[model samples]
Target chain A: MESTADSRVPVLNGRRARNKHDKHQRIFEAASALFTGQGYSSVTTQMVAERADVGTGTLFRYASSKAELLLMVMNEQMRLTTRLGVAESTDAASPNDAIMALLQPQIHLSLAFPENTAVYQREILFGTEQGRYRTEALARISELEDAVGNILARFAQTHRIRKDIDLNGAARTVFSTLHMELIRVSLGRQDPQTLTATLASHIDVLLLGILDPE
Target chain B: MESTADSRVPVLNGRRARNKHDKHQRIFEAASALFTGQGYSSVTTQMVAERADVGTGTLFRYASSKAELLLMVMNEQMRLTTRLGVAESTDAASPNDAIMALLQPQIHLSLAFPENTAVYQREILFGTEQGRYRTEALARISELEDAVGNILARFAQTHRIRKDIDLNGAARTVFSTLHMELIRVSLGRQDPQTLTATLASHIDVLLLGILDPE
Candidate 1:
């Protein structure tokens, strides 16, 4: 009886964990589709729940609000993107280039769904959403920041970057450019090339001073 | 009879313009008070109109929406602040210092009314208000950018800055730092001292580069 009960408990726990993860994945897909296709505001939680084949109660249990729902979807993509960023930048020829490569995926993410991304950016930056998803997303963003800092630290080890410069602050500067360019691009008033050029130049300024070459 | 009609035309025209200007000032004060005291979302156009003692129709005539009302208040302050930026930055010794001085008042403005400023910034940067006030605000922002550009150009004249550098782009980089810091400050999650330190370092990176100064 003890052996049978122990075996059942492990199997039940594994199955339950898998079930929850699968449902979360469906919710992510459903939310992404609705938000990308119909935009963030027009889509309702009820719609996402139905599309995900989950009850509204189930959806709320996962994400307390639509903002949380949005964060959940973006946060998952960001995990993949952060990994992709590290891979892409690991072999960059210079610190500046490495940082650029690290951020290329993110800049494209903004360009891909500029509208929804703008709302996500707003919430993450200034929206008062207090959901755990936001907390996870914040942690995910910090992971990306750490990834950039890691690249910089690697360069500093090679004496390419200043050892004393705040790697974390510098990482923020890189993403600050990304955020500004992302917001500007979302206006649909500026070309996306401007985003790359401006970011490149900002990175250039950060690494190589604008002071006249003595 | 001709003389009487001509004299009355100047007096009557002067009185009408004065009345319109007076009402517009009243509207500005009323909107600023409501937006500041009660916050942007809580206050309605009707409340502003009533406070200003103007008809709601008249308020609508001046500002089509609440966003426009917010923009109107900010734009007026920005006009005065631009002049202050110039005066404050004119005598700075370095391009970076000059740039920082130019942006100080603007930063204070952001800090003082961060919540309203955050909304105003989100709208200006990404919101699709498309009102004349937004247009004016964009123009005003451009003027500030131009002011920063002009400061960089002034420094370049003495060969302190690289003449080859795009002053406009550099000005943009400066403001990009400001925008990011302002948003961070608005989150009220970071120390304001951190804002100055980050911006100063960003300016240092821009002016002095981050490579080991070998």
Candidate 2:
């Protein structure tokens, strides 16, 4: 009887673990779809629980409130984005190429998941909760800026960029250009192909002006 | 007695006119403050009227609803912007110079009225009734794009820009870069002088890459 009971305990534990994982994922997907499709302000926890087909109490087990759910969704998004971004850097030789590679996946993702992008963009601009989340969002933007700056700095040493130029500012400019283009595309103002081509052309312009003196 | 009646009529009419004008100005100022300091949805017409020390009926006379108030504010802003923008082109020599001149004043105004810029940015991004204002907003952006295109076309003909490059795409890129930079500055992310200098430097870079072989 003891041996049988011990064997059942492992089975029960495995089932509980799987159930917990499934519940968390259901809550996340429910929150993401609702928050992205409608404005975040309009979404509620009860609605999320109903959509996820989970009890309201079960929903609370995963996320304390709507804001916490949003944070969790964003956290999952960041993890995926970070992983994809790092993967893009693996084979890149120069910092410029690496940064371009990093941005390409993001651009594709932004296009593919425009609703998600919209939600996050608004969150970055208007959401008031400070501390860790704000820091994370700022860090992502800064990392991209630094990636561009690193390339420009190295290029400048060889006289590729203007010697007196502020590398950080230039990097920020590059990032800002890309960010705006993505927004414009999402807003239906510009075509995706044109946005991509313009981005490439602009980068070339920057490179030509910054390249080593002949 | 007839002369006394005539004098009274003019005095009453003058007072009524002054009261109406005062009410309108009060509503406008109150709405601007609330919209800037708080997100749009959070601000109520009652709050605005109270803040302005006016009756709710008085607020309705100036703006039918909060949405209308936003439209009115934006219209006034764009009118002022257009005046400043148009003035800059009058003394400019070339189309390129004209565009650069035109954008400068608008950029300066954005820096001065950061809150105004923020309100417009949010409205453009998420307002549901945006259809009512889309035409005018897009017309302004298109006008800027056209101005830039004309300059690039002329410059290309003179071998000032790359003869083979797509003028349309290049024009769009230029406008996008400038617009994004202005927003960044208004959001307090970039300093005015740095933005101004960076724009000039980037424009030079762009011209070099596109200009015909000299």
Candidate 3:
């Protein structure tokens, strides 16, 4: 009797879950299309609702506002690419391998979704209102900084870098420099292969400057 | 007498010039105030015209659109700073000295009118419908890039950098790195001095990596 009840409950919940997911997917697709065509400034919640074929209240249920919607879209994109993991140097024989791995995904992301990347770029450079969205964006960036810092820390430890070096500051510098280089590449001013080679060379210089003598 | 006629003509023309100048100043002040308070999207031309105490037609004659008005304010600010000649580093005895001089004014400006800076950031990251304004922004950036490139070229020559090194790419990398760094500083995640020092160190690495071997 207990097994029969459990089976019935899941079947009912499964249909409802599928429907909910389909609706959420529609909302995201609508937001992406509208934002790309009209930009963040011109698009309205009502427009998003209409495009998604949902009521305004339903759209609100999924995303509190347009800013939150934008963040969700970006977060989803990041998650998708992150799962693939970065393939830096197949040889794994070089000390610079870890730094190259850390930078590869970032460069690829900027190249992949230039529009969404621009959206995140604007939000970080100039924050939104004091709302849930702004808080989440700030939190997300902090998490990213921490992740990059952890990677750098591991690299330093494995390579026996100088104990006196300010690892946190070095991490931020590396992260910022890589991010800036990617933005320049996205600006359509430089070829990708040249940018990759130049950045990799610069990273080598920076690491050598601060590292302990091996 | 002929002297009387000449005096009358000078007085009349001077009065007319003053009147036009006054109107232009009023319009610009009004637009700047509105943009600072409500951002670029919330303000309209009618509101600016009303605040300036000018007719709608008069405002249109001065600026064709809201974006143009914002760009005009930025142009005026650049002119004021240019007249100050903040770019000079005549007594600098080293390449780093000259680079520091170039970067100081940028940090000061980023902190000064942060709102205006925010507007321009958005405009560049995402293209606006105002084609002329966007074009002007690109033109100004290219001019500034040229100045930075020339300075780097001179430094490379003096310091004996490698003959085969791409100075153009190196210049772009330097400028682009600093540009994003300034934006990061504005976002309140970084301390100004730390950013400056770290960037200086990064420049050292770049110089060391690219310099020709003795």
Can you give the TM-score per candidate against the true fold?
0.82, 0.72, 0.72
Docking class of 3: acceptable
- Model 3: per-residue Cα lDDT at residue B102: 60
> What ranges in model 2 sit over 4 Å off?
A1-30, A33-42, A49-71, A93-97, A126-128, A157-159, A212-214, B1-43, B48-68, B93-97, B126-128, B212-214
Against the reference, the lDDT scores of all candidates come to: 0.80, 0.69, 0.66
Docking class of 2: acceptable
Candidate 3: which stretches are off by over 4 Å?
A1-25, A29-47, A86-91, A95-97, A130-167, A177-195, A208-214, B1-23, B33-45, B54-67, B82-87, B128-137, B160-164, B192-195, B212-214
lDDT of 2 by residue, B146-206 (tens): 7777766777776655545787766766665676676667677667777777776566666
DockQ of 2: 0.32
Deviation (Å) of B107 in candidate 3: 1.8
Worst 10 residues of 2 chain A by lDDT: A126-135
Clashes of each: 0, 7, 0
TM-score of candidate 3 relative to the true fold? 0.72
Better of 1 and 2 by TM-score: 1
Compute the interface RMSD for candidate 2.
2.5
Q: Interface-residue RMSD per candidate?
A: 2.7, 2.5, 3.1
